[model samples]
Target: MLWPREAGKFIASKARDVKINMEGVRKVAKVIADAVQEGKMDVKEFKQNEVLPINKGLTTAQLADWMFLINTLNFNFWTPDGVPKFSIEYEGKIHTGYLAMVACVNRAIDEGKKMYDPHYYSKLTLDDIKHIFRSDTPSTMPLFDERVRVMGEVGTKLIEKFDGSFINILKQVSGSAMKLVELVISEFPCFCDVAEYEGQKVAIFKRVQILAADLWMLFHGEGLANFTDIDQLTMFADYRVPQAMAYFGALEYSDSLHQRMVKEELFKSGDREEVEIRGCSIHGTELIVEETKHVMAERGMDVVGINSISVDYFLWDYRLNNAKELEKIPYHRVRCIFY
Candidate 1:
C-alpha cells in the first residue's frame, strides 16, 4: 500500500510527458551562443564579467547559453555550498548566514494540479530532458495535434481548468501537452525578457526578491513548510516529526524543485510514522522520532511538535501549545490526489 510519502514517488503527473525538452532548450542556447561566438552578437552586453543576463532580453535561447556561462540555473534551485552563502550588505554590514536555496521551476499553466509531492527523491536527469523533445512526442501534444488530449479526459479537464494560458506556448515549443497547465513560468523570466506578452521591463533577475516572496508563500501554504507542534508529517497522523516544511530545494539534482520538495516532505515528517527528519538543519545531526514537544517544552522549549498531514493537529496546537505567535494564517493546504 502506498502511504503519503510513498504516494509522492508515483507523481510524474505527466510532467515528463509534457512540455519542451531540455534538448530544445539546449539547442536554443546553442543558437544564441553561436551568434555571440561569430561576433554576430555584442559581447559587451552578454558577458558575465561586465553585465547581467537581464539586459539582453536573454531570449529563450540565450537562457540555455547562460547555463554554461553563469553559475546560476533556473528550474534547479542550487547555490554553491561553502561559499559566503547569501551575503547582502545590510545596514552597511555584510550579514551572511544560510544562503537561500535560489532555484526556480517554471510551472507555466495553472491546471490546479497538486504541485507538492509528499515523497520524492532523485533529480530529473539529462536523459529526462532529451526525452521531452524526442521524435516520439506524446499523442496529446498540442504540437502534434491542435487538440490536447491527455490521460483520456485530463486534456479536456485541463482545457476547462484554464485552457488558454499554455496552448500557444506548447504549440510553439512542440506538439506535446504541458504536464501541468503552467509551462516553464519561473524558468522563462530568468532567460527571456518577458514584456507582458507585450508591459515595462521587469526581468526575473531584477525581481529575485519578488520571486522569493512568491515561493516562500507557496511553500508555506502547501504542506511543505509549516510551523508545528507535532511531528512534521509522519506516515501516521498526530505522531510525526517536529517542525514545518512543505519541501526543500532539490536544485542540485533536477530541473524541477517540486520533486525534491516531495522527498523533503517525507524527511520532515516520515520518521517512525512520527518524527522523521531526512537529516537536519545541520547535516551531521540526527534525532529520534518518539521525542515529543511536550517533552521538549518541559525543558522550556515550546517550538517542538509532531507534524500532522492535517490541520486538525496543527490549528489546535500551533497557536496554543507552541510559540506566542500572533500572526494569523487562516487557510490551510488541503491534500488531494492529482492526475
Candidate 2:
C-alpha cells in the first residue's frame, strides 16, 4: 500500500469531486505560522485539554494501554441528523462525540473495570459495552456492533501477539513511528485504514497515525514515546478536518458532492467521492505544512515543531471552536469503521 504521504499526493492528482485551493492553503498556513511564532502550536496543547487522559497522571504503560484502547474504538462517532449525539455526562459536564467515548472509558476505570487491559476487554460481551458506554443522550453510539468487534479483535491480538500490551510493540520499534504504524496495521486488521482508488492501494491509516501521535504527546516525546519519524505522519484525515478546510476555502467540493453533503447522504467506505474528500484533505494539509514552514523560515522564525500533525490539530480545534459557524458547511457523512 502507498504510504499516507504518497497516497495523499496521488489522490489529489486524480481527485474529481474535490479540489485544493492553494491560495486558501497559504492563508491557513499563515495562521499556523503565526501560532507557531507565538509559541501556541506545540504538543503540550494536548496536556492543556483536561478532557484528555494525559492529565490523569497515569504511568507511561497505563497511558499507552489507554490510548491503545481508545483509538481502537475511536471510529464512527458522528451521529445521524436530528438525533441526539452519543453524549456522556462526566464530572458535571456533557461531553459529546469523541470526548464522550473517552469519558466512557474513564468512567469504566472509575467503576473498577480493567477497561484498558486486553485480557479484560477481549472478553467483553455486547451488554458489557452497552453499559460501559451508555449515553446520557437518547442516541446510542454509532456502529456499536463494529466497535465491539474491532475492540475484541484488537484486544485479543494484543494478547496473542504483543503479549497483551501495545508498549511491547513500541519497544520493538526502536523509536521509529513509521515502524509502529506498520506493525499496528500488520497485526491489527481493524487499523488497516486503506482504500483502493483507481486500482492503487492508498493508505489513509487515520487511527494508526493518531495512535503514534498520541503516544508522542503522552510521554512528551521522551522515554517510550520517542518516535524518530513522527513528522512522516500525514493529517488524520477524517470528516471534521475536511469541513474545516472547506470553511477556510482550502477545499472545494463539486456541486453534486456539496449537495449530497447538505442532504447528509451517507457515503460508503471506499466510494469515489469519499476517497477524494479524504485524500484531498490529506494532500491539502501537507501543502499547508510546507507553506507554514516557509513562512516561518522567511521571517527568521524558528520552525522547530511545525508539521502536518500540528496543522491538523489546529484545524480540528478551529472546527470545534467555530462549530456553529461551520455548520453552514455540511461535512460529508460516512458510517464506516476505517475512520
Candidate 3:
C-alpha cells in the first residue's frame, strides 16, 4: 500500500482522465511565493482566517476534543445542486458549508450540550443529531445516519480504550504528527480513509490529516500539539481544492471528464475518474509546494512555516474568498464519508 504522497504521484503518473500542468503549478506557486515573501500569507494567517470559529474563551483541551469530533463528522457537507447550502445562524451571521458545520457544534455547546465529550455523543440517537444539527436553511446535512454512526464509533473507542478523551490519544503521539495520524487511523476504523485503484491500496486519509492540522493550528504548535512531522501531510484531496487548482490552470480534466463534471454527474467513491482527480490533486499540490520553495530560494527569502499543510490552507482559503470567480470551473462530487 502506498501512503498519500507516494500514492498521489503514482496515481497521477497512471491517470487517464486528469492531468497536471507543471507550468500552471509554477504559476500559482509564484503567486503564493510572493505572498509569503511579502508576509501576506503564513501560519498566522491560517490560524486567524475568518472561516475558523473564534477561540477566545475555549480551553486547549476543549478545543482539541471539539476538533476531533468535528473532523470525525466533517465529511460530505456538499449539498446537491440548487439547494440552499446547509447553513447555520450564529452571532448575527450566516455561515454555509464547513463553517456552518462548525457553527452548529458551537451552538449545541451553548445550548448546554457537552458536544465535545465522547461520553455524551456516544449515546446520541438519530433524532438527537437532527435537532442538534438543525439547519437554518431548508437543506439538511448530508449523510446524517452515517455521521451519527461515525460519531458513535470513534466516541465509543475513545471511552473504551483512550480513557474517554481524545487528548489521551494525542498524548500517545509524543509530538509526532505522523504518529498521531497513524494512531488515529489504526485505532479508529472510521478514520481509515483508504481506497483501491488498479489493484493497489491508496490512502487518502483526508479527515485524519485535517484533524492533526486543526489541532496544531488550535494550539499554535505548542505543548501537546507540537508535531515534528506536520509537513508530511499533503493537501486534502477534496472537491473544492481541485476546483481551485483547475481555476488556477494547475489541473486539467479530459474533455469527457470535464463534460461529466460540468453536468454534475456523481462519481462513486472509488471510481477511476474520482481517484485520478483526487490523486492528481495531491501530487499537483506537492508540485506547487516544490515550486514555491524553489521560487523562495531564488529570492533568498526564508519563509518560515512553508509546507504542504500551510499551502493547502492558503489554497482552500483562496477558493472560499474567490468562490464567485471560480464558479466557472466544475468540481468533482463524491458523496462519501471519506472526503
Candidate 4:
C-alpha cells in the first residue's frame, strides 16, 4: 500500500536531486576540450580522449553513479530492503564497465592514445559465443554437437548476433493449444507427466503432453481455468517438453479417491433420460430424495451415468482458519456430466 502520499513525494524529490550533476560534468568536459585546443591531443589521442568511453552518450548522473559504484558498490538499490533491488549479473557488470572506463582513461593519458572505429566493435550474442568457443580451439565437432542442448538462458541479443533460428520455435504461440504442448515437448523441461510414473499421484492425467510443473500447479490450484477440458488435455499429451527440476507444489491423492467415481444412477423413461446415484454418498452424507422410482418412473431418476465432472477432488484442511485459505476446484461436473 502507498504510505499516505506525502511519503511518495519526499522520495521522488530525493531521487531528482541525485539524477544529474550538471556542474561537475561541465568542469570535466572543459578540461578535456582545453587539452584538445592546445594541440596536446593527436587524431589517435582525441579518439581515446574524446571518442571511446567519454563519447558513449552517457548522462552526467549516469557517469557519476558508475564512478561511485565502482569505487564502492553501495547505493540505493531497493525500496525498504527485502529482495536486493539489483540483479547480480547487472550489479557485477556495473563494476566491470567502471573498471573498463578507468582503464581507457589511463590508456589515453599515455602513448597519446589510439584510434577507435565504432564499426569494429559489437556486443556478442549466444550464437557468437557458440561460434567463438567452437573455433577458439581445434575441434572435430561443432560446439552445438559437443554441448548440452541448453547453454543456460542465452540472451536474445546473443541469438541475434549469430543470425540463426535457435529461438524461432519459441517466437509465438502454436496454431492450436495441442501444438503448444507439442512445442513444449520439443523445447522446455517437463516436471511431471503421464509417461513416467510419479509417486506424487497414482492416477493418470488425461493430457498426454504437458509441462509437469504446469499440471502440478493447475491441479493444486483446483481451478477450472488452469486444468481445462479433455480436448485441451489432449494437446499436452502428444509430445515431450523436458521435465523440470521440481513439481509445482505439494499435492497428493489416495488411489481410493478414484474409486468413488462409480456410476451414480441410470433411468430411461419414454423420451427422457434420468440418472440416480442409487445409494451414492459424499462423506457419509446421504442424498435426500422424497419420491422413489418404484412409484412413478417418470417423476424419479432411478440412475444416471457417472461423469468425469462428477468426480470431485478434495484436499484435507485440519485447521479451520487455513481451510478457507485454500481454493476448491470443481472437477469435470457441468458439461462432463451430460457428455
Q: Estimate each model's TM-score.
A: 0.20, 0.96, 0.96, 0.19
- Writing each residue's lDDT as its tens digit, candidate 3 over 10-71 gives 99999999999998899889989888877778676652244454554566667788889989
For residues 240-309, what per-residue lDDT tens digits would candidate 2 score against the true structure?
A: 9999999888999999999999999989989999999999999999999899889989999988778888
**Number of residue pairs clashing in candidate 2, backbone atoms closer than 3 angstroms, sequence gap of 3 or more or interchain:** 0
Q: Summing lDDT over every window of 10 consecutive residues in candidate 4, give the lowest-scoring window.
A: 239-248
Location of the lowest summed lDDT over 10 successive residues in candidate 1? 100-109
Which candidate do you rate higher for lDDT, 1 or 2?
A: 2
Which candidate would rank higher by TM-score, 2 or 4? Answer: 2
Which digits, one per residue and each the tens of the lDDT, describe model 4 over residues 1-339?
A: 111122212222332111112232233223323433455423232111221244444443333222211111111111111222222121123211212333433233233321121111123344543432222112212223212122222222223532322123223332233444454334422211221111121112212222222222222323221333322231111100000000101111122321322221222211111011100111111110111112123434232311111111111101111223321311111111011
lDDT against the true structure, per candidate, is 0.23, 0.87, 0.87, 0.22
Output candidate 2 Cα RMSD: 1.5
Kindly state the number of residue pairs that clash in model 4.
27
The reply for model 4, stretches above 4 Å from the true place, is 1-167, 170-174, 190-231, 234-339
Q: Give one clash count per candidate, in the order shown.
A: 42, 0, 0, 27
Which one wins by TM-score: 1 or 4?
Answer: 1
Give Cα distance to truth, residue 147, candidate 4, Å. 20
Model 2: weakest 10-residue lDDT segment is 46-55
